[model samples]
Target: MTAPLHHAGFFGFDVFGTVVDWRSGVARAARPFLQRYGIGVDPFAFADQWRALYQPAMEQVRTGARPWVRLDVLQRENLELLLARHGADVATLAEDELADLNRAWERLDPWPDAVAGLTRIRRRFPIGTVSNSHVAGMVQLARFGGLAWDAILGAEMAHDYKPQPQVYLKSADVAGVPPHRFVLVAAHNGDLRAARACGLRTVFVPRPLEHGPGQDTDLEAEDDWDLVAGDFLELADLLGCP
Candidate 1:
């Protein structure tokens, strides 16, 4: 096994599927709203549909076609689209009800190994988020999942979304680490690729079930990442985290 890279200054993470189970978490949060509205769609499918809109929604901002906005705003917009697509009468829902449903993104539960693995890794190096989630949402999520982060550095800070060089570059800048000394750990290959392009080291941790049982994408590393771990625990072991 390769020894821990003590020279690395900071470890940044991609939160959604890498640190937390967004699909299951969103599905679980959507269940009550679905039940209340008598929406017969499977909650998981609803979650998937909402997520499907993520990239395009962000792309509008990434391309400067729309003003930069936090992820919460994008998620709320996506939720409305999801409700309309499923034929749910949005007019009947109260503002708080919609807000609560949208806040589902903030209440995600971490994967089984996430907390422990992070705890172990943090012992050796400072850790923070490099996710696209806004600051407020990331704080709530960390609180909900008992995630201990040393800093929150991502889209909100960069005013741009992932796969955008600014997000990775700005995050490393915020951490005061040179791009090459900063490591990005993510489950998605595209995210890793982007970080690598910006001179950040990459770690790919495959989450085969992130999209659910029928998921066929991001099941393995697509390129030669600096390291690949099956899960957080394995990642911790690879990093020689105590």
Candidate 2:
């Protein structure tokens, strides 16, 4: 049997996909940009392809091949590559226009239950983000989504990305909680597995539509996690929140 969540001192949440709808949000933001460039690709496909570069871009930093730069930098680099691949006339775009398009990540909407569920859970325990996003981006995303976080903790803080032990350990350290007492709530099984290996309890909240309608991965808990909830509302209930 799993231990009660009340015993945990801090909850570290994975922001992208887990708390927000990245695909739909990015696609919405990309639609107009694509049309302006006369690109005929599907916006959602563009979103997916752009996202496909996320891990590899971060991997460069994680492997020490590149210095620790913010996720914003990596994302911008990836965006340039994606734009080139799609035959967009990148040089013709004004700096502000390109930056605004990159800022789409900051403007994502939360999962329908996210804000309310976090509010309920926050009534009982401290909650914050353990995301790959930088501080500035996270601040904007929180403001846009109305996600009231107690703190922002993750890759930016640790100078590394997810599945990296330091990201989880550093977040728990920043929260002033022992690794064993800090619970990580994430949709990705690999993320939870990594956190658990670092001594944090894991809660898997699978987001089936995070990758779009035909998503085949992370649809359900893939291991015997500390807890598995269908969504944040259920997570709040399991946590004994009001």
Candidate 3:
């Protein structure tokens, strides 16, 4: 198999589905809150419901319909919307409790291959998260998951969300790497497409289960990404990381 591209000085990752299992992570975190409210709905479906709003919520900011807002704020707003749509009343929950539940975005667990792959890749090049997640959230995730990120770069830095060229370019800038010298690894084709547009090399790592069993998109690389790997460890192996 062809080796993973190694010419880049740093690798910027799409953290949500690429490095961490957001479906499981969000679902798991929501379970306790649901149980406390005695809501019997599937937490997994609830997680999906919350995630379903992600792109559109960010699009508001991207389109300038809304001013720049952190991912956490967007998440909380969307959570309220989901609760209302589901007919679940969280009005009984204290404000801090509600906020803590929303901050569950910070505790997402990494994929099985994530820690090892990033650890190996870090030996050869600096690694950072270029996710649409907020900087504080990314920092919390790194600490919680032992991700070992050299820098946290994302929407918080760009003041915009992914698919926005500034987000990708801002990651490279924050990592102190030229756009051409940075590689972006993501499971979503749209993410890689944006990165590639900004002159960054791209690696597409398919997480077919990112949206859970019913997922249909991003199952394979839609474009000829620079590298396509089964997982981060495989990506590291292809990139010749020891």
lDDT of 3: 0.88
Write out the backbone clash pairs for model 3.
3-238, 4-238, 4-239
Give the Cα error of residue 38 in candidate 2, in Å: 0.6
lDDT of 3 by residue, 1-242 (tens): 24336468788999999999989988988899888877777999999989999999999999999999999889999998888777777586668878988988898889999999999989888999898888788889899999999998888889999899999888898888889888999999988888899999998999988998988999999999988899989988887889
Which portions of model 2 show Cα errors greater than 4 Å? 1-4
Q: Candidate 1, residues 1-242: lDDT per residue as tens digits?
A: 35335588999999999999999988998998899888999999999999999999999999999999999999999998889888977888888999998999998989999999999999999999999999999999999999999999999988999899999999999999999989999999999988999999999998989999988989989998888998889989988888
lDDT of 2 at 170: 97
Give the top-scoring candidate (TM-score).
2
Each candidate's TM vs. the true structure? 0.97, 0.98, 0.95
Q: Considering TM-score, which of the candidate structures 2 and 3 is the better prediction for this target?
A: 2
Clashes of 1: 0
| lDDT to native, each model | 0.92, 0.93, 0.88
| Regions of candidate 1 where Cα sits further than 4 Å from its true position | 1-4
lDDT rank order: 2, 1, 3
Highest lDDT scorer: 2
